[model samples]
Target: MHLSIGEAPNGAEGGATTATRPRDAQGTNEPAEPGSPSQTIVTFADFGLDPSILKAVAELGYREPTPIQAQAIPVVMAGKDVMGAAQTGTGKTAGFALPIIHKLLPLASTSTSPARHPVRALIIAPTRELADQIHENVKAYSRHTPLRSAVVFGGVDMKPQTAALRGGVEILTATPGRLLDHVEQKSTNLSQVQILVLDEADRMLDMGFLPDIQRIINLLAAQRQSLMFSATFSPEIRKLARSFLKEPQLIEVARRNALADNVEQTVYRVDGDEAKRAAVASLIRDRALEQVIVFSNTKIGAGRLARQLQKEGLKAEAIHGDKSQQERLQTLEAFKQGEIKVLVATDVAARGLDIVELPAVINYDLPHSPEDYVHRIGRTGRAGASGMALSLMVDKDQRALADIEKLTQRKLTVEALAVTLPGRRGDSREFSADAYRGSGREKRGREGTAARRDSSPDRDRSPPARRSGSSPNRSPAKTDPFFSRPYEPAEDAGVEAAAEPAARNGLRRPARKVAALLGGKP
Candidate 1:
């Protein structure tokens, strides 16, 4: 479900309505508010929005307000507290930002005094990317107004953030940690804040930022209008909402935890760990996947596979926590600009990184949690565009796959792949699985060439022949003698532990993949 706030049409009294607007195929309103339960709506001018803000919205190519926008805009225009619930990828950022900008425009115009430089509106996000995203949206919505805005997050340096604050911004979008740091340094103030928005409230709770959030909330004035927006409203979110919002208006576009109907999802049942990578690569080549995002369980796996793809002459790059903010930003920019082709990323780099039209998102490794699976796939299929999500499953990943299917309440189409990506350390000759499973005579006919080797001519080669009396104590490593190395379980350890080398290399390493799910061919 998606939620938003906006103004009622001109001369229409301010009041809240729970009715929904009828949304079209693009999740847009047909001359009505998109995703709205009803066709009824209003214009920005009708809501008494500032000329500057209205002009900015129009310039952004937004014709009519979305459902959330149509319903919520009026209440917000009347200065009421709002609680919005919508799926991710909806225009929630502008839902609150537009009205807030309108309300603050007059205040900003008359209050040029240095004493009033303290922030008047605060937007808190769970991730740096989200914070940056909201900041960008605020800038666009408020472009025609004189309001100044800035973004602050933990991964980057503090000096510049401090400087930005000192320059006087009316609206501040930030991640909690850095925001607290600023408060501790006394470099910024929020005492006079009239509006506060907590975007992605569910994510903040999941991040264990409840304490920090509470602290920030306590510092704000009690008389302020509070708006909390999230993809889902859990019990915890409801409790927290009570403390911050006074008689808040609730808006939900979809039922909780539902995915968009537009996405086409599938799974591949790979038999062995060695085959997974090859299968993904084969899929990429066969499907001619372009601008695709391959998600891995660990940072190392993502990096190693990205580098291997590059070595194979495919453009690839990996992004994770280890990369410096500047490098991550640069790599993301390069990917966006089409300088690279395939992008391998961990879940941390996944959410809130919006690409205009991502086409495919591959689950190189399944997500740890079902909710995360939703978030990962959500990166694609945005804004009514069609998208595809493919999950590569080895034997052990069954449980994770099951959880995802159960949570989504849908069956995923599973198929076998012809090949997979090579393992991280070295490339292996592609082997065919079909030969061994064929009819007996056909298998025997191809055995000599496919098997290629035997323990002298006297040794039997059939499956039954090997099972009859073969020694069990022999090391499994001897089968591939040329580059034999004892198998270490740690090589495929947990996601964070595996990405150490990639973290060390950061963005300096050449050959990274740059794929987004919905854009262009891939």
Candidate 2:
């Protein structure tokens, strides 16, 4: 049985709405805090979007604008650049996409000619998954319109992407790297682009895409509408905005690194790295968590955690950068379809993944960046749905927890977790540092060495002990008698033997030659 160290509050129900207020210097409006009732009610119909676009919105069952969407849509539709900061899973795509589609509808072409498309709108995302997600949303939003949309990113064959680009698309979603690849190949032109969006702009900077971003900017038309959206606006992001965006309105629905109120945060204090795996297994097993996404700090750690969970009789799989595009997509699909119980992933899946009604998320390792903590848990508790965020924290995690608290502007509840893993013998206190590292062969080698004898100088210089395959005493193999006999010399006068050979050959020898050659007195 598993017991929660800290009893978390079941977050209050009821949705919050955003309304327009006086703009500040950055063109930002403060919405009411979560759970604080607002007198004004806002809806998508108020945005004056085309009837066809409204049809798609109605079909998708979206009623009102999220806080970010409410603040961003009006400013974007007014033909002004915007810099927005909102937590992940906050309908950030719809905030920008709806307006972009609305603005581009007038230019939408019924003709199938390539010149009519001219790449009118471009949305650049940091990861392939995010790009695909944005493309899907844009496609859904613009279904009734004559606008054509497509996505391109690295991984898989570029031939298909090239063909799509050459054919023409009005709305394009692409990653920085692959977009630059298309630029180099001259497969797509960005000159006629009227609107540009940098989704997850901070993540792009973190991934060192500044140079690629600059190159793409150079290719775009000078006069264009641009929007930048991310969870946090770092100094670099601000600098990027200053360089490109002109009099851009700022839209921040939440504070920097602010977590969703709907996710009940809890941390399980594990004894050490060895206990972390057991703790995760115990929590999932005890809670009977049928679906959960466990976050790992590294790709290797994600793979190892997935394996450990599977060994404990859980259906789990890992998705990370090391995986192929198809592999990650398939794994995500399996997890989404309820075929897999657990999905262990790295920060790659932290942003732009829209998993509807995700019940919970577990942190197998605390993130290095405080900002990442927000995105990691943002996968759940989306759209006012209650969810759980559990993290396994060892002694070293205190500093990270502090960073998270400082960024989120709140303290997190951490409680001790006593884990009892099945199919393993002995106390967890006995796990040596090497026991949890690398392959099993290395640990077994150390155990074998300790089993032989205690450390001593004699052991250092002695020959290696025989392995289990060797026998201490055994009969030697038989040998031939003739080969074993001792050497015997024939007693022929050395000079006479040499003289007989020379005489038989009818050859004359120098007087002292034979003696000198034989090492005799000359």
Q: Write one digit per residue (lDDT tens) for candidate 2, span 1-522.
A: 111111111221122223243233343444644532232436677778889988998888787666666667777888888888765666678888998999988898899898888799999999988898789888989999999998999987999999998888999999999999998999899999999999999889988999999999999999999999877778889999999999887776664555668788998875454467877888898887888989999999898888888888999999999899999888877877889899998887645766777788999999999878878887777656788999987657789999998887898987656665332234232333333335756664664455333323565365668889888675668974445655545644644554675577878665553465666675
- Taking all chains together, the TM-score of candidate 2 against the true structure is 0.76
lDDT of model 1 at residue 55?
83
After superposition on all CA atoms, how large is the RMSD of candidate 1? 17.4
Writing each residue's lDDT as its tens digit, candidate 1 over 1-522 gives: 111122111111122334334344454444434433334454556556787887887877677665567666766766778888754555667778888888887667535554656699999998776788789888888887778899999988899999889878899999999999999998889898899999888888987999999999999999999999887678999999998899887765555446666778888765454466666677777778778888987978888788767877788898887888787778777777777778889876755666656778899888888877877777667666788888887657889988988988877877655663343236444444443344645644454343333213444333344565779665665442323555566756644454555578784357576667657543
| lDDT assessment of candidate 2 | 0.76
